[model samples]
Target: MFTRIGRFVVRRPWLVVVAWLIAAVALTALSPKLESTTDQTEFLPSHYESVQVSDLEKRAFPGQEDQPAAIAVFQRADGGAFTDADKADIQKVATGLQAKHYAHLTKIQADPAAVSPDGKIGLAQIYADNKDLSDTTVTENVKQLRVDVKELLSGTSLKIGTTGPAASALDAQESGDNTDAMIMMATLLLIVVLLGIIFRSPLIALMPVVLITLVYLTANGLIATAAKVFGLDADPSSSTMLIVVLFGVGTDYLLFLLFRYREFLRAGMEPRPAMAEAVARVGETIASAAGAVVVAFLALTLSTMGMLRSMGPSLAISVAVSAIAGVTLVPAVFALLGRGAFWPSKAWKREPKNALAQRIGAMTARRPGLVAIVSGGLLVALALGALGFKADFDMGGSQPKNLESVQAMDDLQKGFSAGKAQPTQVFLENTGGGKLAQDQLAAFRDKIAGVAGVAQVSPAQPSADGTVAQYSVSLAYNPMEDKALDLVDGALRDQAHAAAPDGTRALVGGTTAVLADIRTAVERDYSVVFPVAGLAIMIILGLLLRSVVAPWFLMISVGLGFAGTLGATVWLFQGVKGANGVLFSLPVLVYLFVVAIGTDYNILMVARLREEIRDGNDPREAIKHAVARSAPTMGAAAVILAGTFGVLMLADNSMLQQMGFAVAFGILLTAFVMALFLVPATTTLLGRRAWWPGLKEQAPNPAGEEPVLVGSGRTSG
Candidate 1:
């Protein structure tokens, strides 16, 4: 099957290339705009309490839908108490901003009652006509608000800063834009330089970049089209993630085929036939490795959160596109290039010494048990850090510190309640369809105020028809903190429900409530996604190796690698850096990338080991030979992919930096420690038993060695 595909693609390179171009262009033209959703409510199912509250609020309090989108924090420029003139300037700034008629901002007002008791600070609330922060108009309004406010307050002693949902959304979008550019440029540069260094050919270095970029556009178009057609929830992070995955995954698969092509080239085969043979030989392994990645990602369909569920299809699409391009487009391009793929780099025509890889292989072969114990022990030691891992739900905490939204929040907190900017709302509904008495509403408000974290509760404002009453509750803690989440999730929610008057039901709704529910959803997803992805990946390995036994230990090694990676990240971000918690999605990201994609190396090495054994060499000789032959390829690929992600450390956002570290370190660990040391060592020790029922190969020669097939020990770089 793979041979036929190879011949077809190699024989008709132009047809293959033309088809990709046409598909990419047409799909891109037809694709709809993919809106980035930061709203947590959109990620939840309607069955959750938080989602239900949001729905009820919209229905019962339609007039209140257009709330303040941002808060303009004002203070005297010299850090003194605001004089009457400064107060007048603050009001002037608000009125001027409002008069501009920004796209989403409907009104901007400075209320006399909003000034601090010490007269050191004042507040001007900015109201938006719509609530969707992801809407482009919201960003434009926020940008213009900043500009207008600065110009409006020029000669006065007043200074202003903006903080609120709309401002944060604008900042997040800018941060994402900046980080996306750096990641793309850095990833491309890393791939080009590393591939150039490894293969000594500019042609070979740039080929994967060219092919993957086309695949990226095609995959992106398909993802957007799928979301539009199926109404899938597309999160803000998915697009940025897609770019990184395509380049990293595509480059790995490209190396797999290129090394095989080089092997055939050295065997004196013609360029086109050699290219076909490379695809024929390595195609199944590439496909199976990609299958593991795809299934692991698709398993996210089981996630309860729409964020993960929708992200599943988008990422899975990119990997599938990359796999197809690996076997088809890649081979097609290389077939046309022929020996010119290597260009001036005649090193492709010579066998590498591979001395270091040989020494490492020999050491493993000589003492398989010790090698296994040492490598396995290191991973276990690091795995201990996983116990200390803490999940942070405060999404705002990870944004760049220099962002205007963050700085504004700091200023606002000095004179106002930390949670004043966005307080939780308690909605008491008359489920029996009767009006609630004022005294009963007051009693419920008192009950909510008695909760430990509730600092204040406003008077109940009954809806026009009086079927629902809303009370705003301000917490002592920041709304984004875990303390707030705990307060809202546990005592506050339970107390609200239990304390409601007869014929009434109380529902808590706000940022902390949404985050608490997300925590529950994420916990549920872990139980579902990990087991399903693991089982699915194990099945793929079993099929690829034709050995059930190999799959078991392979998965065990992958699990250990996952734990170690998590542990190391916990130590770095949580322990050493004193972060209150790591990003909630870190574990899922590590598992999908490290456990699923990292298996590519294990598959490559073990497959080579199986091949060497089938050639009638001793088991130890095969381990040594396999390790020696596969190491350079694995090392080069790992370095390139790891470096691609490590560049995220340059980002100002804490989440991006942490994400970059975890994946980069995990890939290096999988390649250098697990694949190179543990896997080969364990296979050496397992000997023919590793193949189990499929072990029909010639038994190891106990008395002496027999020379294997021609060129069995030669190395290709």
Candidate 2:
């Protein structure tokens, strides 16, 4: 299959190149603009309580203000309590803000009751016409609101800061934009520098950047088109992730092909025939590795959250497109360039000794048992750290501490209940289709307020028709905190549901409620997605290796690598740094990259070992030669892939930092420990049994005779 593809591509390289160019241009021109939502509620299924509450609120309170609201908190410049004059000035400022008529801002409401008990802070509610907290219009209005408030208080002795869903969303959006730019520039620089160092050729370094850019554009367009067709909501982080995966994995595939092409050149094969042979030999490995990644990513479709479901397909599409390019566009370009692809670098004509890889292969081949034991023990030691792992669902906690929204939140906590900025709401609706009596509202509010962790409960506000009543309940803990999520998910919800008026149904809704539901959904995904992904990847490995036995140990090694990566992350963040918890999504992200991409190294090494075996080398000799040959490519690819993710450490977001470290470290482990030593050692120990039912009937001729390549009729000596 790969030989035919190589021959076809080599025969009409221009045709293949032109076809890709046209597809890229056409797909990009016609695809919809990919959009993302940061609204957690939107990702949840309607069956969840928070989502149900939201639906009920929309129906029961048709005239209710669904807009996102922020509180502009004002304090004295001198740290003094608010006096009558200061209070008057605050009201005046509020009135001024209302007069400014900011776009997307619906209203500004000021109240004497909003003053803190210490009399040092006053608050005014600013409402936006947009209900979507992540809406760009809401962010724009909040930005303008801050500027207008600053101007309104310019001459006064008061300072103001905003905190709430809208303000936080705006700050996060701005921070994300800055972070995205940094990540892209850093990733590109890293790829160029690293590739230059590895190959010592400007053309080789630049080729991947240029080719991957084309792949990135095309992949994103196709993903956007698919999302538009299927109504998938792409996550805001998808674009950033796409850049990393396309460059990291795309470069890995290119390196696989280029390194083999160089080897064939050293073997005295002509440039064109060498590239063709390289494609024939390495194409199946690239396709198989990419298939594993695509299948693993597609497993996210089974996720309960719409965000994961959308992300699954988006990333899968990216890897699929990248795979196609690796076999088609990439090969075609290199075929056209011929030996000039190496440019001034004459190193391709002579094979280097690669002393380090040779030494590793010699050691592992001689002492397979000791090698396996040491590597296995190291992974076991690291895995223990995962025992302490905890998940933090607080998205706000990931933001930089210096941001205005974060500062405002700190100030708000000083004067008000921690949950004051975003209170939980419990809506009680009349299920009997009649007006609910006002008398029953008090009992419901009292019950919710009486729950542990409850700070205060606002008086119930009934809709005009009296069919529904809404109560704003504040918790003593921050809405994003685990205690708050627990109260909302368990006690508060239980008590509210049980204490509702006889004819009404009570539902809880708020950020905390949404997070609680998200936690449930994520926990469910762990059970479903991981097993499905694992099984799918194992099948791919089995088919690729032509042995069920090799796939089992291969998957186990990858699983160990995954555990070790998670444990290392927990040690760095939770134990050493004393963080409360890692990001809630860290496990899934770790599994996706560490297990899926990490498997690439495993597959590459094992495939090379099989090739050596087919060359009539004994198990020990095969392990040594395969490691000596494949390790350089594995090391280079792993470092580049790991470095790409390591750039994420430069991000201010904790989620990005954790993900960066976890995947980067995992790749290094997969390359240096599992693929380089443990896998080869284990295979040597297993010998013919490793191939089991699918063992080759006869080894290829040891003489320099052309041997058939997998999935291809063509042969290469």
lDDT of 2: 0.88
Local accuracy of candidate 1 as per-residue lDDT tens digits, 1-717: 687788799889999999999999998898998866788898898988889888998898786746768999998888899888888788788788878987678788889888877888899988887767656788788887788777788888888889888898889898899989988998899999999999999988888888899999899999999889988888888877788889998999999899888887887778888887678778998999999999999999888877788889999999999999999999999888999999898999998899999999999999999999999999999999999989987888899889999988988888877888888988999999989888999888888999887878999988888999998888888998889988999999999999998888999988888988999999988898999999999999888888989999999999999999999999999999999989898898899989988898899888888878877778899888889889988998898878877888888889888888999899999999999999999988998899886755744433553322124334222
Q: How high is each candidate's TM-score?
A: 0.96, 0.97
List model 2 lDDT by residue over 460-530, tens digit each. Answer: 88887888888999999999999999999999999999998787889999999999999999999999999
Question: What's model 2's TM-score?
Answer: 0.97
TM-score, cand. 1 vs. native: 0.96
Clash pairs of candidate 2? 1-711
Task: Say which candidate scores most in lDDT.
Answer: 2
Clashes of each: 0, 1
lDDT values, one for every candidate: 0.87, 0.88
